[model samples]
Target: MTYRKKLIEVALPLDTINKESAREKSIRHGHPSTLHLWWARRPLAACRAVLFASLVDDPSNDLPEEEAKVERDRLFGILEDLVKWENSNDENVLGRAQAEIMRSTGNNPPPVLDPFCGGGSIPLEAQRLGLEAHGSDLNPVAVLITKALIEIPPKFAGKPPVNPESRGKIGNEGNWRGARGLAEDVRYYGKWMRDEAEKRIGHLYPKGPNGETVIAWLWARTVRCPNPACSAAMPLVSSFWLSKKTAKKAWVEPVVDREKKEVRFTVMTGEGAPRDGTVNRQGATCLVCDTTVPFSHVRAEGRAKHMEQKLMAVVAEDERGRKYITPTEQHVVFANKAKPSWRPEAELYGKAAVNVPLYGLTTFADLFTNRQLVALDTFSDLVSEARKEVYKDA
Candidate 1:
């Protein structure tokens, strides 16, 4: 009944837990982990395993050794209940776990603290194991997330949302009560916000031929040929491949109309489509006088084209999922208008802010067009209004 035996019990079920966790991924649509994209968040399984292991003690080889052995056996039964509970949300198993935790560690379990809790994974798992958990982080965002997980929920325990939506079968079956109803409110409001945003800024994001919403826009650096005779600027694009997959593979071939002194992005299909080796391999040549241009001239020296208005690809999504479309010259107009107004200060608190000035990026808002700005501003206003409304109702 040493700590080694206790460790074995904890470690034994991990393989099954890991497999179940991996399977849970496909059905984790409403999981709190998906609420926000936190960087380097620990897996729920690891946190659960470590917390359970630390909470319980093994049999002591002393006067109370026999009593300790009996408690340890009961704890082992609780461990089994925990494994079952993790796999399936059995209320009976949870009850058994709670009873065993109280039996082994008395009514008050020792509190677990994670000071630098980035995503609040450890603390959340600790709380799930029926332990009082305290978490903190230097980052305001992290702090807010931890509060949402640990502090906020318990305050509203056994209570439904202030304005609970009609849950039909989910509510009738006793599934959407307590904290679950609060989650529903969040989802409801979230959808409302998304719809509001779309109504305001839908013009900025256009639909493709299949009516798929645009998800991403790609851009490339452009440079001018230094050869004085040519004096022409061209895009420093290495590859024009939309995709490498056989089914939907496509590419853009630069049709240099020397007579017209222009280059056109012609979508190539079928046998004409370039393979990986040939794709984007060609260097930019001046449309006017056919002189080679260097990428260094474009990126470092700001040669040839206008700054920050390069549109390369328009990625769209629908029922079939995402597809990349080669953007025409017309699409570049929307992005070119998104120039920044103010530049960041060269120094902050006497230290050189080298990166900001080096890249010439002013602010996050500076990277949008006037229309986009209006749309974003309107959405922000709507969100503020909605939040205030929610708080008032609450």
Candidate 2:
């Protein structure tokens, strides 16, 4: 089945300050080292205003060290304010619960899904609101964290952090085990290589970038054949193709001169052409075997000129020639299989005509269910409408 086109109006939240206010705040808080702190605090309108005013109101004769200390204090105050808000009712419990509920219901609420399985903050909130919630996470730790937060037993509702020493020991043990296993694997692979064709193929064994061994012992075992006859026992040759000079003589085009105008021609020749009598108008002998070409062949017209040139240039050069001209250039062409044809109707209508129906907008209310969906839809619509109004004013 063809998928339905979905158009979504995604609205991002607005910044707390206008450009003019932001500029003023920047000037008020503009210390060389405190720019980062200034920008970070700008998201919190109250904290930003306080910090900005403090920087502007400071009456000390601006010394570099004094200014730095002031900036540091301002940043610390901002951070403290942020921490308080982050742990407050609006950001901590309520916000988390709302998010959890939305995630469980998929922004559409129940009869769509249970609102209070206590899987996340949302589920716990759902339970508090007299609904059932459900959720899942791939990470076991995340699952535990969520469960602990939502299913807090009466005695363990608030607890201190885990002991640092205990956590450190566990982490250290895991790291040690991993390192030991890696070392064992390396030792095993090294021993295996020594036992197997070490004398013959030791030089060919690969090494890591830092000149240290990298391939594990188990990996080397897989590459080795248990059946001796099927093993790669042969020595690895450097190259199989002809040397550069020989290849050039065999494949490249020869130069030709016609009516004082010289043009190079690419011509394929048989092995027999070297022994046959052929020569160009110039007295130059064949570049391959040094054989003299017959004048009749060189003077011959059309296709014969190419054959005669190939005979003289490539096939007839001397095997022991002290000086040789080799073709210095090469070019490569890449080709792939032809693409399948597009539908004629689709091609005629153009992209815009097809895209309109494909990307048509959709409402969350129509697509989802329950109070969670309702809340999310309302929030999204409010944000979108606000953005539209802002853009219209701009």
* RMSD in order of candidates: 5.9, 28.0
Candidate with best TM-score: 1
Which residue ranges in model 1 land beyond 4 Å of their true spot? 1-10, 58-90, 164-177, 230-233, 236-296, 299-305, 328-356, 366-379, 391-394
Which pairs clash inside model 1?
238-280, 239-280
Q: Alpha-carbon error at 234 in model 1, in Å?
A: 3.9
TM-score of each: 0.72, 0.17
lDDT of 1: 0.61
Q: Cα deviation of 21 in candidate 1 (Å)?
A: 3.4
Candidate 1 lDDT, 154-224, residue by residue in tens: 77665555443534435533555446766756777777788887775565555665677777776654454
Per-residue lDDT tens digits of candidate 2, residues 1-394? 4332111111111232243335444454422122122112232333223222322222122335567456445434432332232332244443443343344344654521322222343443333333444545654554554454344432232232122332344443343221233233223433434444334333433333234442321100001111233322111111211213543423323343423233233433323222221223442233232333343322231122121111111122233332222211211000011121221232223443443222221222222222224334444454455445334533
Please give the CA lDDT of all the candidate structures.
0.61, 0.31
Model 2 TM-score, all chains together = 0.17
lDDT, candidate 2, equals 0.31
Query: Model 1 residue 228 lDDT?
Result: 65
